[model samples]
Target: MPLLDAARAVRENAHAPYSRFKVGAALRTTTGAVFSGCNVENVAYPEGTCAEAGAIAAMVAAGETRIAEVAVIADSPSPVPPCGGCRQKLAEFADGDVVVTMATTAGQSATLTVAELLPGRFAADHMGNG
Candidate 1:
């Protein structure tokens, strides 16, 4: 549960004002390094950064590429899955079988693999190499 704990701890640091919907994400790299991030909203609305994206960026900045596990927590009635774009971002680094756990502050939770979250996801192989 360290991943979840990391996510929950970071959730408190979210910068959500307009939507007021805060989210936090934690990811474990294959090397066992853990990285966490919180959602940061922008005044421009859709230009905001997602918790998952932030975590992924942190992982990359730390020189880790493969994600071993993931957890995301949000203040919602039910476990909130990552946005469509976040799902793709996760897939870019994590394998299909990588587990992604979504949770609510109230303790409600759901789990799914990257493949389960995004079936028929577009992959780099889709683009033929020159």
Candidate 2:
């Protein structure tokens, strides 16, 4: 999809000097707007932001939430899945059914729902948001 293409394009802009592992994410809001982000690494260590988090920040800054779809791209031997933290972050804005497309620079990909990536999510119902 176009969102996967966008994520692939943004992967080139990642500032990953430390790990040299660039990652990019594209998030599609329920309103049909697409936002993209590239990972930014810091010398300080461990505080670097994930591409998914950055994209979510941009989406929220634009007053959009409820990610209907997500795409993440990285140059890895296999499709790079988001870290545990990112999966949770994604779950915060996306439901169990939201698609999460993980891709490699080689164009290989795997698509799974958010629940498939992170089952038993720590979401609103657990917090009584219902």
Candidate 3:
């Protein structure tokens, strides 16, 4: 749960004044490098950055791809997984079976694979990458 802990720590920096709903994300590369990020909301309301996107940006900035694992934490009754757009964003770096752990600040958590979280996801193969 160290990843979740890291995410929770960054949640304090989340800029979510609009919704007052803060979120944090932490991701581990296959090489074991960890990157963390917090959601930054915008006044425009619709166009806001997600915690997962921030973490992915950090990971890419560190010159790494291929997410081996991910952890997301939020202050909710149940563990909240990444949003629909984030699931696609995660798929860009994570494999179908990559582990994604959703956690709540209250200690509740749920673990699932990317495939489980986003079944029938639009993957690289669909884009003819192969």
Candidate 4:
């Protein structure tokens, strides 16, 4: 399925209530596996997880890493960029040039690279700083 179609289908499963901001994400791994996820919110706010994180979690749960492409969808006029936390999380499994596409309910869309979304990101290598 096309990335947009996957994102739209995943969007239907969003469990958002507090902000009423639903989001969906689909990721295609280098191994040719497609994983999808939707935003899940909590009344506690900070416990909420973004769609991108959900997708990554699913991928990890399935024992797969290294994403090649990712698409995100939101029901807003402007394309929704992934949150800072999500961006950082993406860097853990995707290369700096990984393709990230964002889409709006009205069909507007934009594509960017992981590096473009999160510049100067700290990754696993930074954890061992001596």
- Model 1 lDDT, residue 45, Cα: 78
Q: Which ten-residue region of model 1 has the weakest summed lDDT? A: 121-130
What Cα-based lDDT does every candidate model obtain? 0.96, 0.92, 0.93, 0.93
lDDT of 2: 0.92
> Which model is ahead, 2 or 3, in terms of TM-score?
3
Q: List ranges where model 1 is wrong by over 4 Å.
A: none
Each prediction's total of clashing residue pairs, residues at least 3 apart in sequence or on different chains, is 0, 0, 0, 0
Q: Residue pairs in steric clash, candidate 2?
A: none
Q: Residue by residue across 1-130, what tens digits does model 1's lDDT show? A: 6899999999999999999999999999999999999999999979999999999999999889999999999999999999999999999999999999999999999999999999999988789641
The candidate scoring highest on TM-score is 1
Question: Which sections of candidate 3 miss by over 4 Å?
Answer: none
**TM-score for each prediction?**
0.97, 0.95, 0.96, 0.95
**Candidate 2 lDDT over residue span 14-58, tens digit each:** 999999999999999999999999999999988899999999999
Q: Point out the higher-scoring one by lDDT: 1 or 2.
A: 1
lDDT score, candidate 2, position 65: 81
- By TM-score, rank the candidates, best first: 1, 3, 2, 4
The TM-score measured for candidate 3 stands at 0.96
Span of ten consecutive residues with least summed lDDT in model 2 = 121-130
Error of 4 at 72 (Å): 0.3
Clashing pairs in 3: none
